[model samples]
Target: MILKTSKEILREITLCDHCLGRQFGKISISTNERRGKVIRNLLNCLNPELSTNFNKQKPCFLCDNIFERAEDIVKNISPDFEFFTFHAGTKIPEEIMKKEEMLKEKYGLQYQESIKQELNRELGKDIGAIIGKEFKREKEDVTILLHPYDSKVEYVINPLFIYGRYNKLVRGIPQTKWFCTRCKGRGCAKCGNTGKMYDVSVEELISELFLKETKGADSSFHGAGREDIDVLMLGNGRPFVLEIKSPKIRDIDLQKLELEVNQINEGKVRISGLCFVEKEIVEKIKNTHMRKTYLAEIDVCLTEEEKRKIEEFFLDRDIYQETPNRVVHRRADKTRIRKVYKVLTSKENCSSLEIYCDGGLYIKELISGDEGRTNPSIAELLGKNIKCVLLNVISIEEKV
Candidate 1:
């Protein structure tokens, strides 16, 4: 005889349980695993867990008998992934779930279990019990995406990024990624078919070693402003953050990592403050170039008589500057009035004077006077044609 409606039986059974007792939830099977068999044998067993112990019932139409294999699913999915926490995901067959829903609408499955709720409870407990990892209802490191069709599981892995500052003692490297002017990273005769304009850069030199060590797929370099290839990065070296993608190894020794990166450059580029920073650090590093301190090694064609006067004038003052023609091609041509908050002048000799000023002051144009484009330039102030012999970034400061 066809069993009573699922609604009627489920109301009597309460919720699903172990054994053949609850196969009434699954229409595909005619009997519960053990409950049906034992209840059939007893013919008198009555448990509140179920309305009345049944000798026979239907199988789970939604989950097949796999609900019986919840233990197996947990065991197989647990491995090295065990130590880390995880969240359970149910991959119930759409067709199966729909069939149950249809039967419920037509016949009304009042107390019948839902495939989702059943899977969540049964699998969550079993998986958590096996690996000592809990099925977190909140944040989860591991998400077990289940596929019912192929019985496949996909685990999503998170990425880790490390940040640091590196000083390129070498003068030939660009600060960030530079594509081949000839072929743009694509092989071509103009670029010797290598597609790279430069053989290497500060980013590559630093990240290459890290990529190799961590076995990550790729790396990205972020910095505030870049100096010309010919200029030297002195003082503390330009601040930078190197982001490593998909790194399998996260527990790296910062001090040793710093040593490793420095060793690769062989003193040409030295990296320090090797610490783990988040993606937000990259944005901060670029936007926080508000104040840059520079030391200008100026070469002067001044007589000994005029040197002291130049020193005194530079000792304290608010110098105004505008965009220099040299950088007009790359930077926007706009007049910016940056304050010379502090100035420390050193008389290298009668021929040259070293000037140190607060950050954001363009020292190069301050020397040449930007063709009289800058006011109160050292050249304009001294009323003599003077030039900066060399320029160096002495230090950079920001509240970390």
Candidate 2:
């Protein structure tokens, strides 16, 4: 029944082997094009008039010979590609697509593939074979857009991720670059035509090195948590991932890059454990619970006995802290409970003491009491006015 139907179709309209075989692709004997050639040969032996009148090499009436251009397109674009995976796509004329639809309806062909899909598949296979790359259906690294006169090859360079810890040494530099409020990154006179509020940032110091090495178009910095602009990030530093976008070069010597970045930005910002990682690590680092240690220097008129009492008050206690008034403009005004696993106090002077507390606990608010917003705070417990002179993140203990 299939062979007879194929011969009848050949007698009625002109179709190449691929188009004819595509009709019976649902049977899955082999490839549709091969099955089409097999059917054509059998029909030629049975009916000489059909073979002479409607040649198998002739342009398909439905597709209009568009599929035959795949090879020439591949060979032409071969010199421009150095990609690993690709997706092929084509734009066919509306009239040709409508004619194909009409033929499908007339022949009651429910199992046939569209000319566009078959064209992409055929071209993708041939191109993949020549380039020694796989044809990807989704998340393609490269995309070949085929049109009648103009064709384009687009490269989708996947983001390169580097996981490490960054130390922000300065007191005034922000973790990320702050664009000018006046122009919003477009150069303006208010920002001195720099398109930035500040000339230097932790993100710029770290990501600039990577952008130069990878030859990437842009970059984004993802930190586990950020410290205030006034606060210094010391000790082991804070966890972060620098996502390099559209990186032409992925293979890099991370150890050497780390050394170069640190040497360039020596006293400003430094990165450690510089290694390549997957994109998912960015989300993981954001969502994961991390325990941190901070060293806060507070100035208060307290004696040795009073400092001991302050240390005893915070140990193994849950500090009910409301959002500080300083950050209320940006953060939601809500009370949150954070655990103080241990509190270490050292008397630097008669008016200064260094205190170490757990992560997520607002150390400055704990000292000042934030106008009675933070409960069981050092200021509230000691009944003394305490002000944080300097705050620094000493360590960040991340869960494996």
- Winning candidate number (lDDT): 2
Off by over 4 Å in 1: 1-69, 75-144, 302-337, 350-389
Backbone clash pairs for candidate 2 read none
Which residue window of length 10 is worst by lDDT in model 1? Answer: 13-22
lDDT of 2 by residue, 181-270 (tens): 899999899999999988888998888889998888899999887898889998888899999887777677899999999999888888
Give candidate 2 regions above 4 Å deviation: 1-12, 42-57, 78-106, 133-150, 187-190, 332-335, 347-360
Per-residue alpha-carbon lDDT of candidate 1 for residues 1-400, written as tens digits (9 for 90 to 100): 1133432444443223342244344544333445445444343344345444432255543455676566666666633422255677777777867866765575554445566655666677777777776666644545676653455666764445676666767667788767777677887888787677777888888888777776666888888667767657777767777887756555667788788777767858888877877677788877765455665666655665566666667655777666788878867877766555445554554543445555556777877798977777878877777777666665666454
Give each model's whole-structure lDDT: 0.63, 0.78
lDDT of 1 at 350: 51
Provide the global lDDT of candidate 1 against the true structure: 0.63
Model 1 clashes, total count: 18
